[model samples]
Target chain A: NAGVTQTPKFQVLKTGQSMTLQCAQDMNHNSMYWYRQDPGMGLRLIYYSASEGTTDKGEVPNGYNVSRSTTEDFPLRLLSAAPSQTSVYFCASSERLTVYGYTFGSGTRLTVV
Target chain B: DQQVKQNSPSLSVQEGRISILNCDYTNSMFDYFLWYKKYPAEGPTFLISISSIKDKNEDGRFTVFLNKSAKHLSLHIVPSQPGDSAVYFCAASDTMNYGGSQGNLIFGKGTKLSVKP
Candidate 1:
Protein backbone atom coordinates (compact mmCIF):
# COMPACT_ATOMS: atom_id res chain seq x y z
CA ASN A 1 0.00 0.00 0.00
CA ALA A 2 1.17 3.51 -0.70
CA GLY A 3 1.57 4.93 2.78
CA VAL A 4 1.47 8.59 1.77
CA THR A 5 1.62 10.24 -1.64
CA GLN A 6 1.80 13.83 -2.93
CA THR A 7 1.03 14.97 -6.42
CA PRO A 8 3.05 17.23 -8.73
CA LYS A 9 6.47 16.36 -7.40
CA PHE A 10 7.87 19.54 -8.93
CA GLN A 11 6.25 22.78 -10.03
CA VAL A 12 7.20 26.32 -11.00
CA LEU A 13 4.82 29.22 -10.61
CA LYS A 14 5.10 32.92 -11.35
CA THR A 15 4.20 35.53 -8.78
CA GLY A 16 0.44 35.98 -8.41
CA GLN A 17 -0.17 32.48 -9.80
CA SER A 18 -2.19 29.91 -7.93
CA MET A 19 -1.98 26.16 -7.46
CA THR A 20 -2.94 23.31 -5.21
CA LEU A 21 -0.86 20.53 -3.72
CA GLN A 22 -2.61 17.21 -3.18
CA CYS A 23 -1.94 14.76 -0.37
CA ALA A 24 -3.39 11.29 0.04
CA GLN A 25 -2.74 8.57 2.57
CA ASP A 26 -3.81 4.94 2.49
CA MET A 27 -3.16 4.44 6.18
CA ASN A 28 -6.57 5.80 7.20
CA HIS A 29 -4.90 7.99 9.77
CA ASN A 30 -6.91 10.51 11.72
CA SER A 31 -4.27 13.23 11.68
CA MET A 32 -2.84 14.92 8.59
CA TYR A 33 -0.44 17.84 8.35
CA TRP A 34 1.19 20.13 5.82
CA TYR A 35 4.68 21.51 6.39
CA ARG A 36 7.08 23.66 4.42
CA GLN A 37 10.86 23.29 4.59
CA ASP A 38 13.10 26.25 3.88
CA PRO A 39 16.85 26.55 3.77
CA GLY A 40 18.33 26.68 7.29
CA MET A 41 14.83 26.24 8.69
CA GLY A 42 13.72 22.82 9.81
CA LEU A 43 10.03 22.44 8.99
CA ARG A 44 7.19 24.80 9.74
CA LEU A 45 3.63 23.63 10.03
CA ILE A 46 1.40 25.34 7.50
CA TYR A 47 -1.92 23.66 8.28
CA TYR A 48 -3.34 20.54 9.83
CA SER A 49 -6.50 18.47 10.12
CA ALA A 50 -7.37 16.36 13.11
CA SER A 51 -9.93 14.44 11.07
CA GLU A 52 -12.14 14.72 8.06
CA GLY A 53 -14.13 17.97 7.73
CA THR A 54 -11.87 19.69 10.25
CA THR A 55 -8.98 22.00 9.61
CA ASP A 56 -6.83 24.33 11.70
CA LYS A 57 -4.21 26.98 11.13
CA GLY A 58 -0.65 26.20 12.03
CA GLU A 59 2.48 28.20 12.70
CA VAL A 60 2.96 29.49 9.15
CA PRO A 61 -0.54 29.62 7.71
CA ASN A 62 -0.32 33.12 6.32
CA GLY A 63 -0.53 32.36 2.59
CA TYR A 64 -2.06 28.90 2.55
CA ASN A 65 -5.44 27.27 2.94
CA VAL A 66 -6.31 23.65 3.60
CA SER A 67 -9.38 21.45 3.43
CA ARG A 68 -9.92 17.95 4.65
CA SER A 69 -12.96 16.53 2.92
CA THR A 70 -12.16 12.84 3.48
CA THR A 71 -10.08 10.88 5.88
CA GLU A 72 -7.59 10.06 3.18
CA ASP A 73 -7.17 13.38 1.43
CA PHE A 74 -6.07 16.84 2.58
CA PRO A 75 -5.18 19.42 0.00
CA LEU A 76 -3.31 22.72 0.39
CA ARG A 77 -4.16 25.67 -1.82
CA LEU A 78 -2.00 28.66 -2.64
CA LEU A 79 -4.26 31.54 -3.67
CA SER A 80 -1.47 33.91 -4.68
CA ALA A 81 2.02 32.60 -4.96
CA ALA A 82 5.00 34.78 -4.19
CA PRO A 83 8.76 34.31 -4.44
CA SER A 84 8.91 33.72 -0.70
CA GLN A 85 6.54 30.80 -1.09
CA THR A 86 9.17 28.70 -2.82
CA SER A 87 10.01 25.71 -0.68
CA VAL A 88 9.56 21.97 -0.40
CA TYR A 89 6.17 20.92 0.91
CA PHE A 90 5.53 17.69 2.79
CA CYS A 91 2.40 15.85 3.82
CA ALA A 92 2.25 13.59 6.85
CA SER A 93 -0.23 11.27 8.55
CA SER A 94 -0.32 9.60 11.92
CA GLU A 95 -2.76 7.34 13.68
CA ARG A 96 -2.41 9.12 16.99
CA LEU A 97 -0.11 11.46 18.80
CA THR A 98 1.36 9.15 21.42
CA VAL A 99 1.21 5.76 19.74
CA TYR A 100 2.48 6.21 16.21
CA GLY A 101 5.08 8.20 14.35
CA TYR A 102 4.19 10.17 11.24
CA THR A 103 4.43 8.76 7.75
CA PHE A 104 5.51 11.51 5.37
CA GLY A 105 5.16 11.88 1.63
CA SER A 106 8.19 12.22 -0.63
CA GLY A 107 7.62 16.01 -0.87
CA THR A 108 6.78 18.54 -3.56
CA ARG A 109 9.38 21.12 -4.54
CA LEU A 110 7.77 24.37 -5.63
CA THR A 111 9.64 27.29 -7.09
CA VAL A 112 7.98 30.69 -7.29
CA VAL A 113 9.56 33.33 -9.44
CA ASP B 1 11.56 32.64 19.10
CA GLN B 2 12.44 29.01 18.46
CA GLN B 3 11.42 26.88 21.39
CA VAL B 4 13.64 24.06 20.34
CA LYS B 5 17.31 24.43 19.44
CA GLN B 6 20.06 22.31 17.98
CA ASN B 7 23.24 24.26 18.41
CA SER B 8 25.38 22.07 16.20
CA PRO B 9 24.78 22.73 12.53
CA SER B 10 26.72 19.63 11.47
CA LEU B 11 28.66 16.68 12.84
CA SER B 12 31.17 14.22 11.41
CA VAL B 13 32.20 10.84 12.76
CA GLN B 14 34.09 7.82 11.50
CA GLU B 15 32.35 4.59 10.60
CA GLY B 16 31.98 2.06 13.42
CA ARG B 17 32.33 4.86 15.99
CA ILE B 18 29.71 6.31 18.20
CA SER B 19 27.83 9.40 17.12
CA ILE B 20 25.96 11.67 19.47
CA LEU B 21 23.62 14.52 18.48
CA ASN B 22 22.37 17.07 20.96
CA CYS B 23 19.15 19.11 21.28
CA ASP B 24 17.65 21.51 23.78
CA TYR B 25 14.23 23.03 24.31
CA THR B 26 13.17 26.18 26.11
CA ASN B 27 9.58 25.23 26.92
CA SER B 28 9.28 23.44 30.21
CA MET B 29 5.87 22.01 29.36
CA PHE B 30 7.11 19.88 26.51
CA ASP B 31 6.43 16.30 27.53
CA TYR B 32 7.24 14.32 24.43
CA PHE B 33 10.40 14.59 22.35
CA LEU B 34 11.26 12.93 19.04
CA TRP B 35 14.13 12.66 16.59
CA TYR B 36 13.80 12.41 12.82
CA LYS B 37 16.34 11.75 10.08
CA LYS B 38 16.08 13.13 6.56
CA TYR B 39 17.87 12.45 3.31
CA PRO B 40 18.10 14.66 0.27
CA ALA B 41 14.84 14.92 -1.71
CA GLU B 42 13.09 12.72 0.86
CA GLY B 43 10.90 13.36 3.86
CA PRO B 44 12.14 13.00 7.40
CA THR B 45 11.66 9.60 9.09
CA PHE B 46 11.09 9.11 12.80
CA LEU B 47 14.13 7.63 14.47
CA ILE B 48 13.39 7.56 18.16
CA SER B 49 11.49 9.28 20.98
CA ILE B 50 11.27 9.62 24.72
CA SER B 51 8.64 10.70 27.21
CA SER B 52 9.39 13.19 29.97
CA ILE B 53 8.78 10.57 32.61
CA LYS B 54 11.54 8.43 31.25
CA ASP B 55 15.22 9.21 30.94
CA LYS B 56 16.22 6.87 28.16
CA ASN B 57 14.76 4.73 25.38
CA GLU B 58 16.55 2.43 23.03
CA ASP B 59 15.79 0.76 19.71
CA GLY B 60 18.46 -1.38 18.07
CA ARG B 61 21.50 0.82 17.64
CA PHE B 62 19.68 4.08 18.26
CA THR B 63 19.14 5.47 21.75
CA VAL B 64 17.38 8.62 22.95
CA PHE B 65 18.20 10.26 26.24
CA LEU B 66 16.12 12.93 27.89
CA ASN B 67 17.20 15.19 30.71
CA LYS B 68 14.18 17.08 31.85
CA SER B 69 15.96 19.17 34.45
CA ALA B 70 18.35 20.50 31.88
CA LYS B 71 15.75 20.66 29.14
CA HIS B 72 18.09 18.74 26.91
CA LEU B 73 17.83 15.53 24.89
CA SER B 74 20.23 13.59 22.74
CA LEU B 75 20.33 10.79 20.17
CA HIS B 76 23.14 8.24 20.24
CA ILE B 77 24.03 5.87 17.43
CA VAL B 78 26.52 3.11 18.08
CA PRO B 79 28.74 1.60 15.43
CA SER B 80 27.72 4.34 13.06
CA GLN B 81 27.69 3.50 9.38
CA PRO B 82 27.92 5.55 6.23
CA GLY B 83 24.24 4.99 5.67
CA ASP B 84 23.60 6.97 8.84
CA SER B 85 24.62 10.16 7.08
CA ALA B 86 21.62 12.44 7.05
CA VAL B 87 20.07 15.52 8.62
CA TYR B 88 18.64 14.99 12.11
CA PHE B 89 15.84 17.07 13.55
CA CYS B 90 14.57 17.37 17.12
CA ALA B 91 10.94 18.04 17.89
CA ALA B 92 8.89 18.58 21.04
CA SER B 93 5.20 18.26 21.90
CA ASP B 94 3.08 19.35 24.81
CA THR B 95 -0.58 19.21 25.82
CA MET B 96 -2.97 21.99 25.00
CA ASN B 97 -6.31 22.94 26.54
CA TYR B 98 -8.21 23.62 23.33
CA GLY B 99 -10.39 20.54 22.85
CA GLY B 100 -7.88 18.56 24.92
CA SER B 101 -5.71 18.28 21.83
CA GLN B 102 -2.10 17.19 22.02
CA GLY B 103 -0.03 20.21 21.08
CA ASN B 104 1.59 20.44 17.66
CA LEU B 105 5.30 19.74 17.43
CA ILE B 106 7.89 22.50 17.52
CA PHE B 107 11.01 21.68 15.58
CA GLY B 108 14.59 22.96 15.74
CA LYS B 109 17.03 23.63 12.97
CA GLY B 110 18.46 20.22 12.03
CA THR B 111 22.00 18.98 12.47
CA LYS B 112 23.54 17.29 9.46
CA LEU B 113 25.40 14.10 10.41
CA SER B 114 28.16 12.75 8.20
CA VAL B 115 29.50 9.26 8.90
CA LYS B 116 32.75 8.70 7.09
CA PRO B 117 33.75 5.25 5.86
Candidate 2:
Protein backbone atom coordinates (compact mmCIF):
# COMPACT_ATOMS: atom_id res chain seq x y z
CA ASN A 1 0.00 0.00 0.00
CA ALA A 2 1.12 3.53 -0.59
CA GLY A 3 1.29 4.84 2.95
CA VAL A 4 1.76 8.46 1.97
CA THR A 5 1.90 10.19 -1.40
CA GLN A 6 3.13 13.66 -2.42
CA THR A 7 2.37 15.07 -5.84
CA PRO A 8 4.59 17.15 -8.15
CA LYS A 9 7.87 15.34 -7.60
CA PHE A 10 9.72 18.40 -8.90
CA GLN A 11 8.87 22.02 -9.68
CA VAL A 12 10.52 25.32 -10.43
CA LEU A 13 8.78 28.60 -9.69
CA LYS A 14 9.54 32.26 -10.03
CA THR A 15 9.39 34.71 -7.17
CA GLY A 16 5.82 35.78 -6.39
CA GLN A 17 4.34 32.71 -8.06
CA SER A 18 1.95 30.63 -5.99
CA MET A 19 1.49 26.87 -5.88
CA THR A 20 0.29 24.02 -3.77
CA LEU A 21 1.91 20.77 -2.72
CA GLN A 22 -0.50 17.90 -2.39
CA CYS A 23 -0.34 15.08 0.16
CA ALA A 24 -2.53 12.05 0.61
CA GLN A 25 -2.47 8.88 2.65
CA ASP A 26 -4.28 5.60 2.21
CA MET A 27 -3.68 4.42 5.75
CA ASN A 28 -6.49 6.66 7.03
CA HIS A 29 -4.23 8.32 9.52
CA ASN A 30 -5.58 11.20 11.58
CA SER A 31 -2.44 13.25 11.91
CA MET A 32 -0.66 14.69 8.87
CA TYR A 33 2.32 17.02 8.60
CA TRP A 34 4.25 19.20 6.19
CA TYR A 35 7.99 19.64 6.60
CA ARG A 36 10.76 21.18 4.55
CA GLN A 37 14.36 19.96 4.56
CA ASP A 38 17.13 22.40 3.87
CA PRO A 39 20.86 21.86 3.42
CA GLY A 40 21.86 22.41 7.05
CA MET A 41 18.52 23.03 8.76
CA GLY A 42 17.29 19.47 8.79
CA LEU A 43 13.52 19.04 8.52
CA ARG A 44 11.50 21.98 9.81
CA LEU A 45 7.80 21.63 10.30
CA ILE A 46 5.65 24.04 8.30
CA TYR A 47 2.16 22.88 9.18
CA TYR A 48 0.30 20.00 10.76
CA SER A 49 -3.20 18.57 10.98
CA ALA A 50 -4.31 16.61 14.00
CA SER A 51 -7.48 15.48 12.26
CA GLU A 52 -9.69 16.25 9.34
CA GLY A 53 -10.85 19.91 9.38
CA THR A 54 -8.10 20.98 11.77
CA THR A 55 -4.75 22.58 10.99
CA ASP A 56 -2.03 24.55 12.73
CA LYS A 57 1.19 26.34 11.90
CA GLY A 58 4.51 24.81 12.79
CA GLU A 59 7.98 26.31 13.23
CA VAL A 60 8.46 27.55 9.65
CA PRO A 61 5.05 28.50 8.35
CA ASN A 62 5.60 32.11 7.45
CA GLY A 63 5.09 31.83 3.69
CA TYR A 64 2.77 28.88 3.72
CA ASN A 65 -0.81 27.90 4.40
CA VAL A 66 -2.48 24.55 4.94
CA SER A 67 -5.97 23.07 5.07
CA ARG A 68 -7.33 19.66 5.92
CA SER A 69 -10.89 19.21 4.72
CA THR A 70 -10.68 15.43 4.65
CA THR A 71 -8.73 12.75 6.44
CA GLU A 72 -6.90 11.68 3.32
CA ASP A 73 -5.76 15.04 2.03
CA PHE A 74 -3.67 17.89 3.46
CA PRO A 75 -2.33 20.40 1.01
CA LEU A 76 0.31 23.06 1.68
CA ARG A 77 -0.10 26.34 -0.16
CA LEU A 78 2.57 28.85 -0.96
CA LEU A 79 1.06 32.30 -1.21
CA SER A 80 4.11 33.76 -2.91
CA ALA A 81 7.20 31.74 -3.65
CA ALA A 82 10.52 33.22 -2.77
CA PRO A 83 14.12 32.13 -3.22
CA SER A 84 14.34 31.34 0.46
CA GLN A 85 11.33 29.08 0.12
CA THR A 86 13.15 26.75 -2.26
CA SER A 87 13.61 23.47 -0.45
CA VAL A 88 12.60 19.83 -0.49
CA TYR A 89 9.17 19.34 1.05
CA PHE A 90 7.97 16.15 2.66
CA CYS A 91 4.55 15.02 3.81
CA ALA A 92 3.95 12.56 6.61
CA SER A 93 1.22 10.78 8.55
CA SER A 94 0.97 8.97 11.86
CA GLU A 95 -1.39 6.53 13.47
CA ARG A 96 -1.75 8.60 16.60
CA LEU A 97 -1.05 12.13 17.73
CA THR A 98 0.47 11.46 21.13
CA VAL A 99 3.02 8.87 20.02
CA TYR A 100 4.60 7.00 17.10
CA GLY A 101 6.91 8.09 14.33
CA TYR A 102 5.57 9.17 10.96
CA THR A 103 5.37 7.50 7.56
CA PHE A 104 6.74 9.98 5.04
CA GLY A 105 6.08 10.47 1.35
CA SER A 106 8.80 10.51 -1.31
CA GLY A 107 9.11 14.32 -1.32
CA THR A 108 8.62 17.34 -3.57
CA ARG A 109 11.74 19.14 -4.71
CA LEU A 110 10.96 22.79 -5.36
CA THR A 111 13.21 25.51 -6.67
CA VAL A 112 12.20 29.18 -6.64
CA VAL A 113 14.14 31.37 -9.01
CA ASP B 1 18.35 27.83 18.94
CA GLN B 2 18.21 24.30 17.62
CA GLN B 3 16.99 21.99 20.35
CA VAL B 4 18.43 18.95 18.62
CA LYS B 5 21.87 18.79 17.06
CA GLN B 6 23.92 16.31 15.04
CA ASN B 7 27.47 17.52 15.27
CA SER B 8 28.91 15.49 12.47
CA PRO B 9 27.80 16.54 9.00
CA SER B 10 28.80 13.23 7.43
CA LEU B 11 30.43 9.89 8.17
CA SER B 12 32.07 7.15 6.09
CA VAL B 13 32.55 3.53 6.94
CA GLN B 14 33.53 0.35 5.12
CA GLU B 15 31.14 -2.51 4.59
CA GLY B 16 30.77 -4.80 7.61
CA ARG B 17 32.07 -2.12 9.91
CA ILE B 18 30.13 -0.47 12.65
CA SER B 19 28.48 2.90 12.03
CA ILE B 20 27.64 5.12 14.96
CA LEU B 21 25.58 8.30 14.59
CA ASN B 22 25.28 10.59 17.54
CA CYS B 23 22.59 13.14 18.53
CA ASP B 24 22.25 15.55 21.39
CA TYR B 25 19.27 17.55 22.53
CA THR B 26 19.21 20.67 24.66
CA ASN B 27 15.61 20.33 25.73
CA SER B 28 15.49 18.14 28.80
CA MET B 29 11.70 17.95 28.65
CA PHE B 30 11.76 15.83 25.51
CA ASP B 31 10.60 12.31 26.23
CA TYR B 32 10.42 10.44 22.96
CA PHE B 33 13.35 10.32 20.58
CA LEU B 34 13.62 8.89 17.07
CA TRP B 35 15.97 8.25 14.21
CA TYR B 36 15.14 8.51 10.52
CA LYS B 37 17.05 7.60 7.37
CA LYS B 38 16.65 9.29 4.00
CA TYR B 39 18.03 8.42 0.61
CA PRO B 40 18.70 11.00 -2.06
CA ALA B 41 15.48 12.51 -3.50
CA GLU B 42 13.36 10.70 -0.94
CA GLY B 43 11.74 11.48 2.37
CA PRO B 44 13.15 10.38 5.66
CA THR B 45 11.80 7.13 7.05
CA PHE B 46 11.54 6.04 10.63
CA LEU B 47 14.56 4.07 11.76
CA ILE B 48 14.64 3.42 15.51
CA SER B 49 13.61 5.19 18.69
CA ILE B 50 13.99 5.29 22.44
CA SER B 51 12.05 6.76 25.31
CA SER B 52 13.48 8.79 28.14
CA ILE B 53 12.62 6.00 30.53
CA LYS B 54 14.64 3.44 28.58
CA ASP B 55 18.33 3.70 27.89
CA LYS B 56 18.50 1.29 25.00
CA ASN B 57 16.36 -0.33 22.32
CA GLU B 58 17.35 -2.65 19.52
CA ASP B 59 15.94 -4.08 16.33
CA GLY B 60 17.96 -6.38 14.14
CA ARG B 61 21.19 -4.61 13.19
CA PHE B 62 20.14 -1.24 14.56
CA THR B 63 20.29 -0.10 18.17
CA VAL B 64 19.37 3.20 19.80
CA PHE B 65 21.07 4.15 23.02
CA LEU B 66 19.74 7.01 25.09
CA ASN B 67 21.53 8.90 27.83
CA LYS B 68 18.84 10.98 29.46
CA SER B 69 21.00 12.62 32.05
CA ALA B 70 23.42 13.70 29.36
CA LYS B 71 20.74 14.50 26.82
CA HIS B 72 22.48 12.38 24.25
CA LEU B 73 21.33 9.52 22.05
CA SER B 74 22.99 7.43 19.40
CA LEU B 75 22.12 4.98 16.66
CA HIS B 76 24.50 2.10 16.09
CA ILE B 77 24.33 0.04 12.92
CA VAL B 78 26.31 -3.16 13.25
CA PRO B 79 27.99 -4.64 10.20
CA SER B 80 27.00 -1.68 8.08
CA GLN B 81 26.19 -2.43 4.47
CA PRO B 82 26.17 -0.42 1.27
CA GLY B 83 22.40 -0.26 1.36
CA ASP B 84 22.62 1.42 4.73
CA SER B 85 24.15 4.53 3.27
CA ALA B 86 21.84 7.51 3.66
CA VAL B 87 21.21 10.76 5.55
CA TYR B 88 20.38 9.92 9.13
CA PHE B 89 18.32 12.39 11.17
CA CYS B 90 17.74 12.61 14.92
CA ALA B 91 14.30 13.75 16.03
CA ALA B 92 12.62 14.31 19.39
CA SER B 93 9.16 15.12 20.77
CA ASP B 94 7.87 16.12 24.16
CA THR B 95 4.59 14.42 24.96
CA MET B 96 4.17 16.18 28.27
CA ASN B 97 3.98 19.62 26.77
CA TYR B 98 0.80 21.54 25.96
CA GLY B 99 -1.52 18.49 26.13
CA GLY B 100 0.64 16.60 23.62
CA SER B 101 -1.71 17.38 20.72
CA GLN B 102 1.24 19.07 19.09
CA GLY B 103 3.20 15.92 18.69
CA ASN B 104 5.46 17.45 16.11
CA LEU B 105 9.08 16.35 15.93
CA ILE B 106 12.10 18.57 16.27
CA PHE B 107 14.85 17.35 13.97
CA GLY B 108 18.58 17.86 13.97
CA LYS B 109 20.85 18.59 11.05
CA GLY B 110 21.26 15.16 9.48
CA THR B 111 24.50 13.24 9.18
CA LYS B 112 25.02 11.61 5.83
CA LEU B 113 26.43 8.11 6.22
CA SER B 114 28.41 6.58 3.39
CA VAL B 115 29.02 2.85 3.52
CA LYS B 116 31.62 1.63 1.07
CA PRO B 117 31.70 -1.96 -0.08
Candidate whose DockQ is highest: 2
Against the hidden reference, what TM-scores do the models get? 0.95, 0.96
lDDT of 1 by residue, A1-113 (tens): 66899998999999999999999999879989999999888898898888889888888999899998899999999999999999999999988543247899999999999
Candidate 2 TM-score, true structure as reference: 0.96
State the lDDT of candidate 2 residue by residue for A1-113, as single tens digits.
66999999999999999999999999989999899999999999888888889888888889999999999999999999999999999999997664475899999999999
Please give the lDDT score for candidate 2: 0.91
DockQ, candidate 2, vs. native dimer: 0.67
User: How do the residues B58-94 of candidate 1 rate in per-residue lDDT, one tens digit apiece?
Assistant: 9999999999999999999998999999999999888
Candidate 1 similarity to native, TM-score: 0.95
Off by over 4 Å in 2: B98-103
lDDT of each: 0.90, 0.91
